[model samples]
Target: MSKKIISVIVALIFILNSIPVFAWTPAESLTSSSVVLMDTVRGQVLFEKNAYKHLSPSVMCKLMTALVTIEKTDLNAKVTISKNAASFNGLNLVVGNQYTVEDLLYAVMLSQGNDAAVALAEYVGDGDIKKFVRYMNTEAKELSLKDTYFVNPTGLYEKAQYTSANDIALLIKAAISNNTFNVIFGARGFGWLNGNNSSILTNQNTLFWSYKGVDGGKLGTNTNPQSFSAVTTASQNDKRLIAVVFNTSKESAFSETAKLFDYGFSKFYTGVLVPKNISQRSIEVDNVKLDLSSKIDVYYTYPVGDSFIKNISFIPNEKLKLPVNTETIAGVLKYTLNDNTVIEVNLYSDKTVSAPEDYRTKIKEIVTENRDLVTIVGILGIIEIILIIKNLIKFMLRAKKTRTQQ
Candidate 1:
């Protein structure tokens, strides 16, 4: 075969043999109800089964209520029980008993008391239950919880009380961010304010005892949906993850969560930032070279399967058309399985920068001009070497002629 034809055939063969990676899918049973396991580092869903499906969050909604309450009120503040606040169909605070906001949180969350939820809400909302409900729904919207709608602070059987597993996960993520809230969630029990009786608020989540590195979370139940969800954080070695599981039978919730947790730890890995102190490099802006790179403490949030090392693909713009500014979000780090189950980690500037007047056009023009200059310089360098060699020969010949004359 001709050399040209042989080269073309080899190139075609290489292209044909390469196959795209496949994504990992969940087993059949897990698909019936929604399930989502995310790596907090990359914020990527490691395994999702009907992740967007809407279902009642049950008492898991308390996680959000607890968060809102924590935001508005101090734990040490005094809570005065009202007629309605103390008298709920399930889990009542004694009609006249006074408690601190912290104690009420334990009752509402650990004891799963609807009355406690109301009492705390009234205290935080300044005796307005409707306004508290408004806060709940508004905050849900702020979190971009598409299918979540809260009718009451307590996750009771209400007409519009519903949330997806994904929505609950977001709520849990927000709650765990607060250090005080984290301590509340993890505690096995709390003391009473009136010195009524020290109630040991055992976590309904059996997984807390069974699972290794299990930080405490919330659990919920209702008749229509025999559901329970908990936000758990577990650690093995130095790697840790926050996992949330929503809407499974009470009998099955703990076991299934264990299964999910085990599946996550066994199938995936959390890695530390490579080269620990390595910072992101800056991109060039118009004429003025500005350093936009951030010192990111990044860890891979994905399952590494059996192989401890995983590949993260950082895809920058093929051409830098986006303006470099502090607020501008550019590029993404995509972590995936051998098969393409993709999750994105964002790249942001560590410091602020101002774009040149003609931002978009200037960026495009600069990239094109820079690339052209580099190519021109590379070619000129080769030509310059050849010219230097010719000049050196001419100088040597002149020196030899002078020697001959001497």
Candidate 2:
């Protein structure tokens, strides 16, 4: 072969080799075994990989612990640390120390204090650790988490104490709904002072350092399974994203979470599936027409350049009864994507349609409707009566005249 032909062949081989062999998939660049990205506002999953795989959440369980504590007890209440709680090796809490619930919560979130977890659990559970664990499981069930079960409040590596990446993301969403929890979670660091000593507690979640728009998150690491997990929330352009990564190295957890955030923000955006003022049309029921109420805007987070509005269908309720009251629900607008119902909203009537009037009222209505025709008929009847009377008077006068002539 000529030199030019060989050069062309070599160049083609290099280009082919550079192309990826497998089709592109989400979280492909991450080392985590399970990952999920969720749009909190729309409650939609933007990306996932084995998101339901059950694994030990380790210290990440503190999220639930903090949530249960904050919800069930007053933050200003003081908690006396117990010996069992202080025995946890990594925590700096002292036995018999008294700290406010708010202080312990900050310690648990910012410092990842297992001791604080125990103290809060004990205080919230009224000194029963088992009861607190049961509360955790109950809350998990209430959230409809199928792949989660908490064996302890501290998430101290019980084989049965496991949760999925998706469940953690869901729990985070619920946790953030509370203003108190949300504020605590977002804190970067806090000052600490007790009777004996004072120290600073810093947030361990590395996303605050590496990623922009990092609002809050939790981190976990366990040696039993050699797993690391992280859940983080970030916001940009008036949109917020929650990302969870499980069963990865400590360093990879934050990195993978950032990767998920990047994917979500770059590929997806909030769009209106159903616009406000969706319909100006009227619906007829029982010969009575009624106008529709103003429509509500339904939003969804979807892939860029994809249109979901076209797939929306407005279907009036077939079983609508007569005499529909104003602002009553008369139908539903359903939005379906890929043969699945994504969003649905009730449609209401703007005006009432009263039932038909009674027979007497109906007769009066008919007369009023044909007033011109009734007036013409009345005039013709009066003229006929006058003619009859005139004929009768003429007959009587002729009869009298004939008798007199005879």
Candidate 3:
């Protein structure tokens, strides 16, 4: 209707569109060929680029080796190094020397030792390296690493021995669940000994020295194909994240990992989405009301927007007996997050649910809980009973008189 008004509206629209809109994404700044940033607790991926693409894991396979060795053998068991294990160029072990599984695992973790990986593999496999590799593959499959395969325990530059960024992230995520693995991975170095053959193994992953909240890390470098990868895990303010990067410089591998971590830390927040012992409902148990509550806290990570929604479904016990205390699980609250993640919090009774009492006992307790009302009702009931008896006696006397007259 007016050309000037339409012109003003057009200018406003253009100005609105011109304003720069920014979203937190890792691709522009991160240079690794493949990368994945994931929330460790939720297993939720924050960012990924070519994460499924097959890339050389290099010495990073030691992460899997350490995990397998721990599962199959005792850490205190002594492992004798063989010629095959000593053949690896890095961290050469004495051919006949014996080292504890724990000390050698330190070599694998901190030194990124091919020799140490092979030794552990041979020891766990009963002198069969391929047998140990099979175990690695089995673990990879079990972890749902669709793009990973292990041909060598040492992570030598074999064309067939390749793993994706996502696989490494997930692999280490599972590996860290074991306390032994977590402890060993976090160590910077150790004075390991094979009898008098003492040597110091220093961790190659720099995150321990550089980053705060850094707990675990694994580093890998390959000269045969010239590739570098790092797996870093850190926790801060109740949030733990895992970052995996491949095909970058040895320096950038750690730096890029830190970048991803900082991004996650700044952009996301994690806390209890559903609090522990929160009352969900109240139900009658044998004429007594009991509050049903969640057993534990359900934590989740999200950005600025509260994007995920929770749906709780209560599954009460089929035969929940009365007189149950707070220890007894009344049921379970199955909280479904976006049709993918399900957190089952066991529901418990807030207080004891007692069995129904006998009438006398019930009255006594009622009187105890409320004396004034109980007294008033008790006196009235006794009076009513006496009045009925008195009326019955008068009627009986009248009947007796009539019979005597007859």
Candidate 4:
């Protein structure tokens, strides 16, 4: 090759290599049987594995029971124990225990009592488990848990009761968003006040102590699935991540959950993947190169040490027209979190660009606005000019007549 050609090619290669590159770290294997990690605010799914397969979620179902009961009854409202509820296979709240909704909620959640969960359901539905079951399904649908189906609140091994890790994560998101629900689930311990003041059942979520900045959560187990599910909210340096893991070993779920939380907080960060100052490449509009004017920004609070890749994809909307309206979406910003879950942002015109106007059109607009005043002024000026011309002609004739008389 000629020396000139070789030099030009070398320069181009150097320029291309100088451009910056960024990416989020890929995930490592976690100990849980199934996991679903996500950013709650941005709706960004950071990690997952076998999240949709239906499996048993043991006492973890109490979250739903507690939530549904709270939805139908006030905390202080009294609910009498039903014969059917008291017979469920677990720690039975004695048949004669007259308790308020609040007391049962504490006992059911802290002790993982089957009877307490059933009693609340029966009290809410007037001794009808079938109607209460319907309520559970309806609530699940409302929360968009299409993969979850419920036949009972206690999450006992029933023929039809089942949920997946994904559905459980969705349920946790819904529960934590509610102010009252978040407060109740995270509560460490509350008094039963049923005569024995010394009787206390603490929460089962151990991460609250072993894990730092750990928020409210729950744990569940059963023979068929050996399922364990937990919702944890942890923050580092003011950044936060909401993590969910389901169907893990009873001994390892806490450690697995903690490791997942650690990975999230330690590897990634929350900021605009596409920095605010950077401009998108230009696009052709009506044979003219119009500067692409749309911008994208992503924000979520996360742990400092999590791995993340800043992927920005450009998409075109064929339906969009040239000189785009500021309000119209011309494209989308597809953000792929390192975990492979994706989200999209609509790209719109950065500024208003309307159809152009001509000089004549602008003048016409001005004339129309001042039409009455302009017309009257113009008529008066014409009359004044005509009168001056007539007076000048008369003076000229008078001067000629005076010269002839002299």
Candidate 5:
């Protein structure tokens, strides 16, 4: 081929390669009554379909129960199953048999144990499961979840107890935020803690089958009222995401949650906006150059082939002062998308300097601190000056008398 023709072809290929192979688009084929895909790392809703519609998301509410349990009690402590708990339909809990709180947590999340959740509630509530339900409602209120209400820890179908997809996502994020709770949620299978009832139990969450980086998930199904739901957490390349689906079929719950994860993961790629401890820009304070940089890495998620603009501003415009230590705030760094601030970090100075004005101020402060000593020194200096003046007068008179005698 001619060199000119080859060059033209190469240029065309390069231009085409720079474009996205597949453009970003909203997720489709989702039939769940309520759905939400949240970027848990940033806590932003990446995708949603009727996310706020209130419905019975069912057993996924065990996530909230597990959250309360981890916060209020010890995980190593053993909880004896009660008849009320043992009467529940799942996990086959034996009345008066003791199980570690940690094991029961696994049951709550993995084994789909209504009995295990109730047992945990009774122990944590001082033998009153209703009190634990109250605790869950209180926590939901504190978390600013307006659509969540709890009537039981087991997540059994109740007309009075209901939650939205958004609330369930929030619950999953909160539940996994704790290390212990996260471990329990991530468990694919766990053996019984009791020696007599020892048997390996597998997690009912189906996301583990086809999803990559699925850390943990929960599936809730109530056939009596025909409600099915799923909450899933997964991570990819240091970014974590949560997906919640409600009012879907039992099989579709898993598939729909997986689809949400796929959409959420494929929609964005992690990019380091600015490196840590490297100067993005600089400002001068009292003639000392202040290189502005974040103490930690500044990262943001964006669609593939997308670009961003950074607009950083120093707040109060006066924090930039002399005698700046390493800990001094240089300014606030803001990363924006479409004019909305996605994240704001406090920029710090890599240089320290003391201005002449600062030194004078410092001296004044020292003098104020030791005013008595300063006063004594001032009086002694004035007395010494007066003595020198008197000696000079005597010497001048002696010199004049000698000249007259001569």
Candidate 6:
């Protein structure tokens, strides 16, 4: 081939190679069997795919185990490892070895140590493994997770132990809220020495290396069921999100979670549903005026270009009685999207209203104090005068009739 022709061919190849071989679509691109992306600040789901499907959570259950341990036992407390705990696969925790709860927590969170999980559970459960699992179930119930159950502290492949992607996201949200859990979950690596034995823990969450704004995460895998799962959290541009993926390959877990976080941060954001220092207004009850309290600093997450701010309606409680006390709930501020209620916040009275009475002196004083009260007082005064004149005329007519009968 001629030199010019060869150059042209090479250029064509370069252009074709630069073109995308596949289009990216979140719903179709993900490889996980189940996935969920949530706005942690607003507790709203940004994306989901079979999110409720039951699957073996594998080691992701350690998050709950860590949470229970953090709550039940002090971090500085010393825990003696038992034979059962030491027998846990993966970590080489020696039987009768002693380690601080805090050190073991790092292992459980960052290193994915099954032995550490059992040790923490034993300490928190008072040496009863079954009781520790019960505590995990109790927490799941308290979180209102309908599809989660725990048969062990370590997320081993138990036939009866299973959780959904949605439930795992919820669990992570609850776990990361704690300062201790958050710190350990985000650590890239932690190291310590226990009686001449050097122990080091390192995070397996690849998103920390591959993505930005990754705060914390957990990974789980099981060969018996051939399952892989991951839960991750990230914050960007004032928005925080949690993502979970299950039944995926180890590599796909990180990539899929990154895609979910990208979708969430790019497509959703927190918006003010009600602005702070909203103008205070008044409601009239039984001819008495009660001032409504202002709503301040309320927000919710929504699609990037869509907003519920304009759709919010402040509806005062119609049944509020006169003489409403200050700070009493008098109404609700309803936030609606597509005509469906999304949030309802209670409205309270800013100031109390006294009982309504036709005291002329009080009315005169109110009218003098507020120009707006004049019209109301004037109409009431006219009505009172008309009723008084009608009574007087009836009395005169009755007296005249009595005189005529005499």
Q: lDDT of candidate 1?
A: 0.68
Which clashing pairs does model 6 show?
A: none
> lDDT for each of the candidates?
0.68, 0.81, 0.83, 0.71, 0.79, 0.80
Candidate 1 lDDT by residue in tens digits, 1-406: 8999999999998887886645433463452366777655545566667777767656656877888889888898878788898677545567766788887788777767788888887877778888888888888888788888888887777767788776776666666778888888887666654455555667776767788877766677665656566656666666555655665566456656666767777777776544222345455545544343333555664455353335677766444543555555555666565435455555655555554556787867776879988778879999999999999999999999999999
lDDT order of candidates, top first? 3, 2, 6, 5, 4, 1
lDDT of 6 at 265: 80
Candidate 3 C-alpha error for residue 137, in Å: 3.3
Candidate 5, residues 1-406: lDDT per residue as tens digits? 9999999999999999998876434454677777888877556677788989878746656888888999999989989889999999778888898888888888888866888888999999999888988899999998878898888898777878878888878777766778988888888888875546568878888788778999887778765567677778889878898888775487888877777777767777767777898986688887767787888877766656676454554452475677788788778766666325377778888877876656788899889999999999999999999999999999999999999999
Cα lDDT tens digits for candidate 6, 326-384: 66778877766642437776767766676666789686777778876787877899999
Cα RMSD (Å) per model? 19.6, 10.0, 10.4, 12.6, 7.4, 10.7
lDDT of 4 at 234: 69
TM-score of each candidate?
0.67, 0.78, 0.73, 0.66, 0.77, 0.77
Q: In lDDT terms, which candidate is top?
A: 3
| 302 Cα displacement, candidate 4 (Å) | 9.6
What's the TM for model 2? 0.78
lDDT of 5: 0.79
Native-referenced Cα lDDT, model 6? 0.80
> Could you tell me the TM-score of candidate 5?
0.77
Q: Which stretches of candidate 6 lie over 4 Å from their true place?
A: 1-24, 279-282, 290-295, 308-319, 336-341, 355-406
- Model 3 alpha-carbon drift over 4 Å, by segment: 1-24, 141-146, 159-161, 192-199, 222-225, 282-290, 305-307, 310-331, 352-406
